[model samples]
Target: MKLIDITNNHPKLVNEQLSNTDAQMVKVYSLGQTTVIYTIAPTHKDLVIINPKRPIRDNEIDYVLQRTIKAPLQSLEVTHVGNFVEITQSLKKKRPTFVPRFS
Candidate 1:
């Protein structure tokens, strides 16, 4: 999914779109090369968002999000969000962690 680079433009429109939908909670999934976000709103369809540019690293996630969403990550009241590595690890845990030993 191609994310329109709104860091330099259209920040207001994007904000309005998100706000109008009343989607405050979002679930995020990170594939190897990109990230996917699902906005949860009972009144509207879940908004699936990919990245705006290249895959954002954990260290720079805050900066990238601030630029793209035009709001500081802290102020977004974001909690219970999982990053790529975290989700991946959790998935791994749920699967059977056994190796076949053919004698």
Candidate 2:
């Protein structure tokens, strides 16, 4: 996915993009590296999440599963809904143990 494409097609992602909060480092799997994207929360400022490494492939998804089982960060799916792109974290399964939980 190209940055221009994302920006043009999915304005929501770019509009909601945010900088990393908290000093702690978070490990996330690459979805499709093109550029950064963002989302708007009901409350608080927009949140930005990193795009998966460029050229998302089956192998990359496999690598994410393998590594995540060992160490996981919250996983989110980026999808386009009509004219807007939405970023949603999957609740299908538990996040990796290494992932920090908010109290």
Candidate 3:
């Protein structure tokens, strides 16, 4: 039997793309050569599609979400395509309880 640890081997994101309009907003983060699209709808949950402009690992999806989204995700749904993956997470919007006052 052979086992491998692949959690720490994914590429890190170096840049991001933000698009905003009246209809909806889109956020795209690029990890090295791979690109992942993350969309959050006001009426629905957030969606993350890993189309992988290049090769991408599954754990990288988690990394992107952790870095981008401030809200904790709930009811996660992950779908694996031929060579990519899609992740859906319902975000509970919460107002920040603490506001720092810089003097």
Candidate 4:
């Protein structure tokens, strides 16, 4: 008989699409400084929808983006999240050329 070792793998995410029909409760990671919650969608899911605990203004896009992403994601323009052509096109259309800074 042959067996495999899955000890080093960390089950930090909730993969609903891949879960067996038996598992139920799961842990939520709260190590971030923002005190925000991130409910990761399952493996088959395409988005990590955020329903902020408090009200947020649409004009706060820049502030929210800056706080959410510590560094520029320029490198990902050709890969990763930007790899989706349709999404890139949509962002290009909705995004403004100049982004105003807030105090």
Candidate 5:
């Protein structure tokens, strides 16, 4: 599936929404000491519903973490609904890999 790297300033509302839909918080990579890579679960069945004003439920967070650890790469699809944005996971083509060579 296509891997989409999440940005650092992706709005706390978005993150909160992810938490609501059971979006597991995977690996967090430090980038330039400011940015981080937050990987989530990859399952076609899993979905992350976003609500800007509403807070994420606790049970959803637990379910997300449980499923994320078991999956490989997480799939996320972003869509805007009203004033909220939904991030859902779906089956997509595998992402490409890049290897750097030393000079």
Candidate 6:
């Protein structure tokens, strides 16, 4: 689903919006060429995010966020790129395999 494009221009407003709604922003990253995503933590209700303070569909997207999470995911895309080979290649890195354990 499309997320309210609240990129990190104004943190205070975003915090207030999330706090007032009792929602927490878990992460903010790009999904692909144009798609910026905002992943939210589980809460009593759906999230209502602050509008982006500035333009997010620009070159600053640095697009790529394909981790796993357990909650509703929202996205916004620029939808102009035809080739994602470079984008995929750039984000492709071997991550250290670390499994966490609790005592």
Q: Pick the candidate with the highest lDDT.
A: 3
lDDT of 1 at 70: 50
The C-alpha stretches of model 2 lying farther than 4 A from their native spots are 1-24, 28-54, 69-103
Cα lDDT of model 2 by residue, 3-24, tens digit: 2224466534333343443212
lDDT of 3 by residue, 5-82 (tens): 222343232122223322144555556555555555654444444444544465666676576554443456767665
Question: What local distance difference test score does each model get?
Answer: 0.42, 0.36, 0.51, 0.27, 0.42, 0.36
Q: Alpha-carbon error at 19 in model 5, in Å?
A: 3.5
lDDT: worst 10-residue window of model 2: 21-30
Error of 3 at 36 (Å): 1.2
Model 6 poorest 10 in a row by lDDT? 83-92
- Model 1: ten consecutive residues of lowest lDDT: 84-93
What lDDT tens digits, residue by residue, belong to model 1 across residues 3-40?
Answer: 33333344464466567866655544444345545454
Q: How far is 7's C-alpha from truth in model 4 (Å)?
A: 28
Candidate numbers sorted by lDDT from highest down: 3, 1, 5, 6, 2, 4
Q: In model 4, what lDDT does residue 88 have?
A: 13
Off-target runs (Cα >4 Å) in candidate 6 are 1-7, 10-13, 31-35, 44-66, 70-103
Better of 1 and 4 by lDDT: 1
lDDT of 2 at 52: 44
Name every residue pair that clashes in candidate 1.
none
Superposed Cα deviation of residue 77, candidate 1 (Å): 1.8
TM-score of 3: 0.49
Off by over 4 Å in 5: 1-18, 44-103
Model 5 residue 51 CA deviation (Å) reads 25
lDDT of 4 at 95: 52
Off by over 4 Å in 4: 1-61, 77-103
Instruction: List clashing residue pairs in candidate 4.
Output: none
Give the number of the best model, judged by TM-score. Answer: 3
- Each prediction's RMSD over C-alphas, in Å, is 16.0, 11.9, 9.9, 18.6, 15.1, 12.8
Q: Estimate, for each residue in 1-103, the C-alpha lDDT of model 4 and write its tens digit.
A: 1112221242544455228522333322221221122222222112121223533223232233344323343422211222111001112224547988999
